[model samples]
Structures are given as structure tokens and as C-alpha cells.
Target: MLHQEKISVRQFTILVFMYTLGTSVIYLPSLVASYGKENGWISVLGSSLIGFGVVFILNKIAQLDEKKHLFELLEFIFGKWIGRIISVLILMFVIYLLATNLRQIGDFITTQVMVQTPIYVIMIIFILVSLFAVKLGLEVIGRTSEIFFPYALFSLILLIVLVAPQADFSNIQPLFRENIAGAFLAVFPASEVPYFQLFVFLAIFPSVNKPDKAKKGFYIGVALGSFILFIITFMALMVLGPDFTARNQYPTYILGKKISIAEFIERIEILVAIAWFFSIFFKLTINFYALSLGVSYLLKLKSVQTLTTPIAFFVVILGIILFPNIIYFMDFSQFYWPFFAITFGLFIPLLMLLIGMIKKRKQGNGSQTPS
Candidate 1:
């Protein structure tokens, strides 16, 4: 296999930024408010710090052998059988992530946009478009993002600007005086959603054209994305109040609906919704890329093109059954997912770094091949 699909570090950075904002932009304000109350923005800061550490850890893992895919590197660090076991475990998480993101798009469209469309129909259409993006290959996905990513940012900035005037400083009053533990507790939950899932990039790290710059890009993207998330959360609390923001499933969307500039700019939420669609689409595309490639590696397949369809079908099925209801989904994301995320996000990466560093020392330590 030639393994020739390469993406620029710039594009890699863009993907990271967009992926970080994906669904978090739509749902994070409420999640944070439920936990952190008035200090949700502070929680975003704590999460961003943790995000920096995550990037550093994953960057070290990639440097273990920038030429090898994540599965190959795992096998080198843990040997054949254990590595395969770990790979399967990681892919299971990947499937859950893919299914959840797909389910989100499905639910959002049906409930918020169309109001009458079947969820399955929405999931199917979304998966098909994402399937095409993934099958076209990573480079194509990267380039397509280059073309459309700006509008997402522009809309996002406009969202922030328009929503800023309505903010009430008293809504976020007391300045971290109440329920401070809740604010600290909110850190992991905020970080877990986007920061933890970044390991998906390991599957495609070997495809980066410039490893050094791509590493920087990862950090920059996380910083920027977390800042964006913080601003959104702050505005949501200031504009909607903590109680209202906490109860709403999609505070960011509601913020959009409230963007009435002199009463003339009414209901441009659909325009803002376009930005959400793009962000989530790119996130799904990158994640499905990892899922397809990981499965291909697990199955020892030479090509993943044909595998994409069946895998997408499986995702749709899991998306349907994964959550009995959105309430269950939100509960899982809030109360339980932080613990689940750390196993792969922190534990596995740290384990690999420890073992790989030990192995490198034993082999004279100049980035030589293990075994």
C-alpha cells in the first residue's frame, strides 16, 4: 500500500477547530450551566487547559512513529494480541461516537427544522452525504473544508456579536462565588466532549504532510475552539440566565432565534443553522474516516471504499437504538460520559506514552523502530 493521501497542516488545523466546535457549540452551554451554574465560562477555561495537555500527549504518541497508523503503533507498543484487543475497544468507542453524532443530526433536524420528518430518514440522508465525503478520501475532505469552513466561522462570529447586546451582567453575577465546586466539576465534562475524542486523529496522523506544524495546529485549534465555546457559554448565561440556559437542550440555537437586530433581522436562525450543519458534517466526516479505516485495519482489508456503506448502515441502526430518548442521551453525556471518556482519552494515551518511551530507551532512543 502506497498510503499517499496527505493533508496540509493548515487544513488539519481547520478540521480540528471545526470538529471541536461541532455539537458542543449547539449543546455545551446547557451542559455546563447544569453543572457550573454561573461559572460555566471558567469551566471552559479549565477544559482548555486540559485540552492542551491532551494535544501534547497525542503529539508524543504520533512522534513514536509518524509513518505508522494508530493501530500499527498500538501493536508496536503492546504487541500483537493486546494491541488487537485494544484496537477493538477503541473502535467500539468510535462506533458509539459516530452513532451519537448521527443521532444528534437526526434528532435536531426532525424536532427543530422539519418537525415532521422521520428520524431514520434524516439519519440516512446525513450518513449518505458523510459517506460520500469519507469515501472521497481524507485529502478531498480537507479541501472541501477549506472551501466552506470560513462561512461557519463568519456565522459563528456574527452569532456572538448579535447575541452580545442582550447580555445581562447580573445573570452571571457573584463572579464565581456560588457553587464553586460545581464549576470545577464542570471542567472534565466540558473537556471530555471535544478534547477527549481527539484521539480519532491518531488514525490519520500518518497522513499529515508536516508533523511538526500539524502538532502546533492541533494546539491552536483546541485553544481557538475552546475560546469560542467559552464565549458562547458566557453569552448564553448572560442572555438567557443560568436556570433557563441549563434547562434548554439547545441554548445556542435559541440564542440564534433571539438575534433580532432592530426587529428587522428576524429568524435568521436557519442561516446560523447552516453553520451548525457544516461543523457537524465535518466532524462526522473525520470521525467516520477513522471508523472506516480502523475497521479496515481490524479486518485486514486492502480498501475501505466498499466497507463504508455497510458501516454507515450499521451506524444508522445503532443511532436509532443507542438512546431510548434524548433525555437518556443527555443524562449519559452529563453524569456518566466523563468517566467513559477518560479511559481512552487519558488512560490509554498515557499508557502508550509510558510503554513507548520505555521501549525507545531500551532501543537507544533516537526514534528508532520498536521490535
Candidate 2:
């Protein structure tokens, strides 16, 4: 297969942050609040720590196999049969994540903004756009993120500023009253998913222009993205308070709705929606690229482009099946999926890193000459 072109370290970081932030920014506060209540922000902080650790594990693996993607590294570490099996599992998990994210975006748009539009229409449009982006390959997606990420960040800052008038500092009061366990539990879904999802970026790490900078870029992106999410969560809580933020499905959207510049410039929710759509667009593109790359590697295809359409179609179908309704998606994500994601994204990569290191050491020790 023709290799994808390399992307700059800046572009790589943008791709990681934009993909990680995405649609989660809209609904995450509510999900976190569900588990955390007044302690939701704590969950956000806790999740950031978990995410940092996951990035460290992934970076170690990337450093060890600077010239290869995760699939090749797995093959080298475990041999073909077992490696391919593990790759298949990872591929399936990625596909599921892509579908879930796409469906959530589609559902969000339909439910909140375009009640009349069919959800399938939104899903198909995004899938097709993502397919086109994937066909263009990783460079294009990375560059696209570099462009959109700034606007996304700007929109976030704008929302926070606009909502400042409504924020009540007392909303998040009684801090640490929930104890350590409650704080950790709240962080489970909020920070974990955003930070851990970067694992899939392993597919593109080999294509980074400065491979050594991958770790720095990855962590910077995560820290910056988490800080943004944290601020958003804080603003949402401060503005809406726990009771309201918890009940609202999209606290960020509501924050936008509450923004009023002299009362004449109200109803700026459209701006917020546009920013969110762009964020989710980059996100879906990256996920689609990863899925295409994984399939191409598994089948040993001459080009990753060939799998784009097939996978896009499958994603649309999967989006429809995997989320019959928003509630089901929310329940699965909050209650069950975070643990599964932790296992696949964090624990498994750490295990591979340890095993790869030990195997390399043993081989090194055994290969010494008679000297």
C-alpha cells in the first residue's frame, strides 16, 4: 500500500485534540454531572490524570516502534497469528467508537437543532464527508484539524466569556464534600473517554514528521484539550449549577443559549452549534482514517483508500444499529463503556509496552557474543 504522507507536529497535535474533544464537549457535562453532581468538575480533573497516564503508555509504545504503526508493532511483538487477532479486536473497538460518536452527533443535531431532518441524512452526510477525508488520507485530516481547531477553541472561549454573567460561583460549592471515591467515580466517564481515545492515533504516529515529538505533542494536546473541557465544565456548572446542569443534556448548548450581548445579540446558539459541528467533523474524519488504515493493514491492501467507502457505509449502518435512541447510548456510555474503554485503550497498551520491552531485553541479553 502507498504510505500516507507525513504531517507536521502542529498538525498532529491539532488532530489529536480536535478528535479527542469533539461532540463530547456538548454532552459531557451532563454525563459527568449524572455521576458526579456537584463533584463533576472533580471527575473532569480525575479523568485528566487517567488520560495522562494512558498517553504515557501510548508514547512509550510509539517511542519503541518509531518506524511502525500499532499493527506492525503488534505483529513484531506477538507474531502474525496472535498479532492479527489482537489487531482485529482493536479494529472492532475503533469501529464501534467511530459509529457511536457519529451516531451521537447525528442524534444531537436532529434532536436539538433540526427536529424535522431525518437522523440518517445527517449520519450519511458525515460518513460521506469522512470517507472523502479518509481518501485524501491523514495529511489532509491533520491539516484540516489545524485550521478548524483554532475556531473551535475560539468558540469555546467566546462561550465561556459570554456566559460569565450568568455564572454563580456558589454552584460548585461544598467542594471535596463528596470524598475521594465520589470524585474518582465522577471522572470515570468525563476525562477517561476524551483522553483515552487518543490510543487510536497510534495508527498515525508513524507518519508524524518529528516522530520523537509525538509524545510531547500528544500530551500537550491532551492537556490543552482537557483544560478547555475543564473550563467549559466549570462554566457550565457555575452558570447553570449542579441541579440544572445535571438535568440538561447539553449544558454547553444551554450556555450558548443564555448568552446575551445587550439583549439584542441574543440567540447566539447557532455559533456554538457551528463550532461543535466542526469539532465533531474533525473527530469523525480522524476516526474514519484510523478505521480505514486498520483494515488496509489487516488485508494488506495496496491503498487505504479502497476501504474508505466500505467502512463509511458500515459506520452508517452501525451508527443506526448501535444507538437506537439517545438514552440507550447515554446509559451504555456512562454505566458500561468507560470500563471497557479503559481496558482496551489504557491497560492493553501498557501491557504491550511492558511485554515488548521485556522481550527486547531478553533477546538483547541472549544475543551477546562470546566476548
Give the clashing residue pairs of candidate 1, or none: none
What digit string (tens of lDDT, one per residue) describes model 2 on residues 257-334? 999988789998877888888878888887777777778888988888887887788888988988677678778887
Cα deviation of 284 in candidate 1 (Å)? 0.8
Off by over 4 Å in 2: 1-4, 178-180
| Weakest lDDT window of 10 consecutive positions for candidate 1 | 362-371
Listed in order, each prediction's TM-score against the native is: 0.97, 0.96
Best by lDDT: 1
Model 2 lDDT, residue 267, Cα: 90
Residue range 239-279, candidate 1, lDDT tens digits: 99999999898888888888899989788887668999999
What TM-score does model 1 achieve against the real structure? 0.97
Residue 318: error of model 1 in Å? Answer: 0.6
Residue 371's C-alpha lDDT in candidate 1? Answer: 41
